[model samples]
Target: MKERKIALSQEDFAKINKAVQQAAAKGSKDSLILYRDLALVTSITNRTVITAIDGNNMAEHVFTNIDSAVIVK
Candidate 1:
């Protein structure tokens, strides 16, 4: 997948989303946002996100889900 979605507050998400939009629009900077979910038993990073950006190839993100459900296909 070229994006990740995690369980976060709407406001927090908005902030992150705004940054991405800005970067994408500005075409000056790029962003790679990583998100994760706590394990039911253990509280740890359960996911990973890897985003790649460039002049032409922008808005390409990746989501390596540790829980498999955070980023649905």
Candidate 2:
């Protein structure tokens, strides 16, 4: 499969980073929902976002393999 890149502004990236940090503090090792529309499946143990989804594309989609969620707004 082709690799898809998600672009974020510096501020948006910072938001995501901060959210990730907070989730880590809570010992969250699951997918996180950011900005209501975006879903970030992260590995708290690895401190990385494995995958992401935008709101427009989240319609008719089911999020599985996730244990947690965080709203950035």
Candidate 3:
């Protein structure tokens, strides 16, 4: 028997697709990618990375903590 690992799901793909679509429509159609750092994540969100998580790299993002909510950039 073999174990299969799933990478991106439908919802996660939607979130990423939405960003790209929104960017294209708004003329901000630069290269958009999702990166995740499990270390900083603590938990997880629909914001999954397009790449595999290797301990060699730390995810890049700007976070704002406001009123118990976290905002990602």
Candidate 4:
């Protein structure tokens, strides 16, 4: 697991929770969530974040095994 250095506000957690719920409703097992400049991989069933990546390291990153993607603006 990678170190989590992102500073997430309460509102950010709310948004992410909402997005995860929506994905779960759609039967998504794993999801990729994009919020601001951060990207996170989450397990909908477990309600856990698998990994988080910042914008600085996102350019060459490739996501796999995700059944859905949610972009939170």
Specify the highest-lDDT model's number: 4
Alpha carbon lDDT of residue 26, candidate 4? 94
CA lDDT, every model vs. true structure: 0.34, 0.73, 0.35, 0.92
lDDT by residue for model 1 over 1-73, one digit each (tens)?
2233334578755654554444445442323443332111111232122332332333353333322222111
Write down the TM-score of every candidate.
0.32, 0.77, 0.38, 0.93
Per-residue lDDT tens digits for candidate 2, residues 38-71, read 7777777687777777776677877777777788
Worst 10 residues of 3 by lDDT: 63-72
Candidate 3 accuracy as TM-score: 0.38
Full ranking by lDDT: 4, 2, 3, 1
User: What TM-score does candidate 2 reach?
Assistant: 0.77
Clashing pairs for predicted structure model 3, backbone only? none
Q: In model 3, how large is the Cα lDDT of residue 33?
A: 38
Residues 10-61, model 4: lDDT tens digits: 9999999999999999999999999899998999999999999999889989
Which 10 residues in a row give candidate 2 its minimum summed lDDT? Answer: 1-10
Residue 61 miss distance in model 3 (angstroms): 11
lDDT for 68 (candidate 1): 24
Determine which window of 10 residues in candidate 1 has minimal summed lDDT: 38-47
